[model samples]
Target: MFTKILIANRGEIACRVIKTARRMGVKTVAVYSDADAGAMHVAMADEAYHIGGAAAAESYLCYDKIIEVCKQSGAQAVHPGYGFLSENAAFCRALAENDITFIGPPVGAIEAMGSKSEAKKIMEKADVPLVPGYHGDEQSIEFMKNEADKMGYPVILKAAAGGGGKGMRIVWKAEEIEDAYEAAKREAIKGFGDDHMLVEKYLTKPRHVEIQVFADQHDNVVYLFERDCSVQRRHQKVFEEAPAPLMQNDLRARMGKAACNAARAIGYEGAGTVEFLLDEDGSFYFMEMNTRLQVEHPVTEMITGEDLVEWQLRVAAGQTLPQKQDDLSISGHAIEVRVYAEDPDNDFLPATGTLTHLRPPQESAHVRVDTGVREGDEVSIHYDPMISKLIVWADTREGALRHLRKALNEYQVVGLTTNIEFLATLAAHPAFVNFDVDTGFIAKHENDLFPKREHITDDALALACLDVFITRDEEAQAQADWSGDPFSPWHSTSGFRMNDDNHHELYFVEGDDIITVTCHYRDEGYVMELPGGDVLVRGERDDNGDLAADLGGRRMKATVVRHGDNLEILVHGRAHALKLFDPLAAAEGQDEVSGSLTSPMPGKVVSVLVEKDQEVKEGDSLMILEAMKMEHTIFAPMDGVVADIFFNAGDQLEEGVELLKLQGE
Candidate 1:
């Protein structure tokens, strides 16, 4: 084992590698950029160093800086965790030239599988099953359209140099090819610094199943079973599970064999995942091979009881395989869901904010949360907005799903939009619970997945009122403890009625609605008259701060948190964010709506398609903004003429900053 290793990554993966290195008694050196100076990974490492600016090109992807830091910290090896320099053959080669070990596959293997186009060619020659498409050096959009015309209507154009739903576009018909080609090319150029693309015949309803393979320098390889990554949105996976639900033993063996063969074909070593698109007819085609540890590797680890990072280190240290193919077997089922600071209702656009409050589910042997962020950490727009990976395990798939849903329900995140509720709903959905899912799961069941917007129920308000009453009671008791004289009625916040009935009013704001909750003190409880009607509520908070109470003659359990200025309450697995309406404060108001088109989020203006005084109809593209490596186009809300343009292409701006102004036609 290396005495000390440098992690060439950030966020959860860096912290993940650090954890395993510490377990192995190996010291870790973390490299951070300007944005990640106080990041969790930097604080967890034994040694830390500043690399460069906040941009990935200046920091994580800067070969010279990483190399210099590794040498300075006396790190004998570098663990490039999954992204940035992970699959870069040149970086691997550079590490070799510096006499440092690259904790991944060799340069030859990376080169062979680095490009999706080249990897498909090699897989086809190696007798791996392949989908019918074009995998040649074709950059011309017209050429790509012709190839798609031949392959059929449904073809996916993927970046030749990268993956992760970046630089990828799915064209359903010939009419959509031109716009898709332009957008895909633009995204590819920005994401990978490459414009080359390869077209693949997109399967209509296929399950994305990937086989995890590990190899050692002694030519030994073993597959740690398969992960079903079928649930996705915008071509990126959201839920993944190990051993692939309903997978037959024979199919698992065959797929595992094919994956190992592909690894051996490239002389691969360390951890690699060979992805396949499992068709409806039980047939599977090769996708691309990830040449490093995956973001969802925890599912595999939970099922197989293996530490893949430790395996990567041992393999890099020239050790033999830890477990042979015959010795390896699945113990249980595991599922992983990525909790990102993104909005599921808005094309899953990444969010950036300070996590005013972050509380994930408690971890145990059955549930694990791998995260690099703590409460109050700023989720920067300079990188991915993933908050954590929640992994759960059980003896059966059903039990694992139950665990997953429960954990998701207990998870709480404030101050930013999250997909937690969406994930919880999807986890408990019948189709997913029944294991009938594919890549088109989200789109096919959009109605069920997205769901109708939930309203603030009277029951929810009752719970919130119950919480408020309980907090007041606690505060009164604390005041009694702090007062010099205990019998002072002036210091008592408790509504101690001598003869007349005691009543008070409170207000809560939810969006445009202001609900008035009137509390009438009764027998040690209060009757709250909120939105729907009056409801009797009384609750006692447990040690965990969870309230178990009787509301409106019904038993209920709830958790209410005072996060910042809002009150977040979770009841019956649903969450509601509310703000206390202050009557004494300044009156609330809203700005007048104008013909000003502003940036919805902090990002760089990619392109300005319209000039000043340009006439446009509704839905006409005005400009493109790139944030978190994804491009979002600003469209004219109504038929209008452009009055002025404020920001030019390549200018970075903050959220709500005016990009252009328009006048009604």
Candidate 2:
């Protein structure tokens, strides 16, 4: 085995490769951009080097810099971890020219499978099953439209050089074709620098199942079963699992063979994945082959008991295959959920901020976490927003699902918004539980998933009030007249009678209205019996005069203050700011609260679409903000005029920052 290898990537994949390299007694070198200077991957490697700027193009995509780093660090080989320069045939060729091993497929295979159009041609020639579509090099708009017309409506426009859902769009009608084509082309040029596209017939209910294939230089290849990546949003995979839930023995055997054949046909070596689109009719078609390790490879590793990165190094070192096709057997079911810094309720837009608190669940016999970030690291807008991959394995699919759900519940991230709630909902969905969903599941059930719920119970309100009252009573104890006021409710323990008759009114907000509850003290704490005959538990004040209470089975930390005849209790991160009103004063101080549009997260303003005083319609793109390497367009709240623009392009704004003011008339 090589003594040292340079990982020409960053994030969890880089850390992942280092882990296996270390296990094999090989030294690992990590390369990072300016943004990743203090990243977790850098800390995991034996040695680290700075490559270039923050953006991938200046750093991770700089093949020359990576090669130079490998030579400087005396790395015997370089591992491209699935993105950036992973599938670049020219980069692989250059590595070979430099006499440094590239731990991936040969250049010839990459060239054949890197481009979607060329991959289609190669698959067709190799007798692999293919979908009916136009894979020709016709770039004219009219030609694409005519091809789409022939393929029927509801076709997909894909960038010839695209992956990871970039430069792809689905058109459902002729009128949507031109706009989608233009958008796809523009994004393609920006993302991959390739405007060429291919039109394919859209499979309405397709399940994405990919087969893992490993090959060596001795023309030996073996398969590692399949992964079902059907859970997706915006064409991006959200969750994945190995040993597809509904897979049959015959189908698995046939798909495994086909995947190996495709790899062999391209003279493939090292770790690669052959992706397929399985339609509702049980027919599967070759999608494309990824020429490097995948983000969800942990699922395959858990089921097959194989370290694919180690296999890559061994194969690159010219080792023969260690096992034959007959020797491989899957052991269990493994499922992986990609934890990202994104908000599911906000159209799944990427979020950027410092991760003030991040605690992934500890790994156990059934759970593993692979992450490239720590608590203090900033989630920048220079790269993908994926923070980590949570993988769970069990003897059965249901067991794996249950394990994954429990792990997700224990996963904590405090600073930025995430899709944790969404993942929980997905796990609880009946279709997902029964494995009856497809790629379009999110789009079909978005309405049920996006709305935010505010579930306030009467028990919670009572608990909040009691918590605050205890805190205030503790503070008043130092000045209470407890010498001879036993019956006056101020002469018992802690300067307040434990068995007194005192009444206090608490006010809180529920939705748009305020609710007033009256509680009378009985024991050490208030014991107002609910009309439904349910009991409530309240806590005592701590040394700091703060009370903690269990309200409706939910814990609450509250601080209570009293002024004159009004009682104020702070709960759930809000200050309440309530006013104590006599029945006569309440009628005189009733007014409605107004609403305003605020920035949902921190990011940089990319473009301001509307000028001051401009009239805009609802759903119109008011401004575009770039965050976490993705652009999000903020829309108008309602039909209104732009009263003021508080921010312009290049302005750095914080979450809840007022970006604009609207006037409704």
Candidate 3:
């Protein structure tokens, strides 16, 4: 094994590689940009080095810098954990020229399979099945449209060099092809820097299944199993599962064989995944090949009882296959859901903020959380917004789903929005529970997946009031303890009642609505008039700060965190963010302003579609904010004239910063 290896990636995958390297008695050197100076991966490595600027192009994608760092740190090899320079064949070649081993496939194989268009040709030549489409090299718009017409309507245009579903557009009609073609080309050039594309017959309700294949220096190859990743949104997978649901013995054998053959065809080495689109009739067509470790590899690890990173390290070290095809076998069902710092209700836009509080689900042998961020860490706008991968294992699929739901419920995060609730709802959906899913599952069951907004319950309000009342005492006690006076008189004011009839009122702000709750102290506890009806509550903070409440004789427990005026409560697998209302501030009121379009999150303004005094209708695009590598458009709220413009095309703005203003008539 190499004494030290340089990880050419960031976020959770970097941390993941560091962990395995440490276990194998290998030292790790982490390379970070300015944005990741204090990142978890940097803190976990044995030694760290600063590469370049925060942007990927200046740092992670700069292969020369990475190779130089490897030389300086005496790293014998480089592990390109998915994305950035992972699949760039030129990077592999550069590493080879520098006499440093690339812990992935050789340059020849990567170049052969790097382009989706080229990969399809190779797969077809090797007798592997392929979908009926055009993989030609013509970049002319007319040629693409003609190919789409030949393939029939509902054709999908995909970037020749794309992966993870970016730069893809599905066209359902001929009239839509022109606009879709331009849009797809723009995105492809912006994302992959390759305007070349291919047209394919888009399957209406196919499942996205992939086979994980491994190869070694001795020409040995093995396919671990299959994973179904059909639950997707905007063409990207939200979750994945191993040993595909409803997979039969014959189908598994056939797909596994094809996967190994595909890997061997390209003389591929190390760990790679071969993706395919499985039709409803059980027929499968090859997609593209990922030439590095995947984000969803943990599900395969959980079921096969193997560490893929460990295997990658051994294979790169010129070791033979760890086990043969006959020796490998699946044990149980495993599922993985990507926990991202995104708002599911807001079109799944990336959310950036400091993690005021963070707590992953309690993990055991059967449950795992792979993350790189912790409390007080910032989810920067310069990279992907994914926080962690939650993996669960069980003897059966149903049990795994149940455990995943429970784990999501137990997960805690504050100070920013996340998709935990959406994931929990997805795991509980009947179609998902029954294993009846496809690429369109989320769209088909949109009503069930994106639930209606929920209101603050009366019980939650009562608990919040009680939490605030007791938290003051806790703070006082801590201050007294710090001063070496644990028996301070201020601690005795909690629950202090001059008489049984004493009463007090507290206010809470739920959005724009102010809720007033009157608490009347009594010998037994307290009775308060709340929304819907009157309820009695007796609650107190435990040693761990969890709120233990007895509401109307029913006991409940919750974890709470407060930041500024915001109070976050977690109870019964649900989260609620509320604010403490200040009536005095309301009395000193400020005027309400409208007609201003501000950024919902911190990001760079990619485009300004409207100009000053320009007439626009409702729903028109005003500008686009690019954050976390995703673009979110700001729309005009109503028909109006652009009154002013504050920022230009490439100015970085903070959250809630006004980008433009409009005057509506």
lDDT of each: 0.90, 0.82, 0.89
Better of 1 and 2 by TM-score: 1
Q: Per-residue alpha-carbon lDDT of model 1 for 38-145, expressed as tens digits?
A: 999999999999999998988999988999998898999999998899999889999999999999999999999988899999998899999998989757888989
lDDT value, candidate 3, whole model:
0.89
Candidate 3: pairs in clash: none
Give per-residue lDDT, candidate 3, residue 560. Answer: 81
For candidate 2, write residues 480-556 as lDDT tens digits: 64443434454333333347656666665455556667666555456544434444556766664556676546676
In model 3, the Cα lDDT at residue 408 comes to: 95
Q: After superposition, how far is residue 632 of candidate 2 from its true place, in Å?
A: 4.5
Note the residue pairs that clash in candidate 1: none
Off by over 4 Å in 1: 470-486, 494-501, 540-549, 553-557
Which TM-score value belongs to model 2? 0.82
Kindly give the number of clashing pairs for every candidate.
Answer: 0, 0, 0
TM-score of each: 0.95, 0.82, 0.96
| lDDT: worst 10-residue window of model 3 | 492-501
Comparing 1 and 3 on lDDT, the stronger one = 1
**Deviating ranges (above 4 Å) for candidate 2:** 456-665
Clashing pairs in 2: none
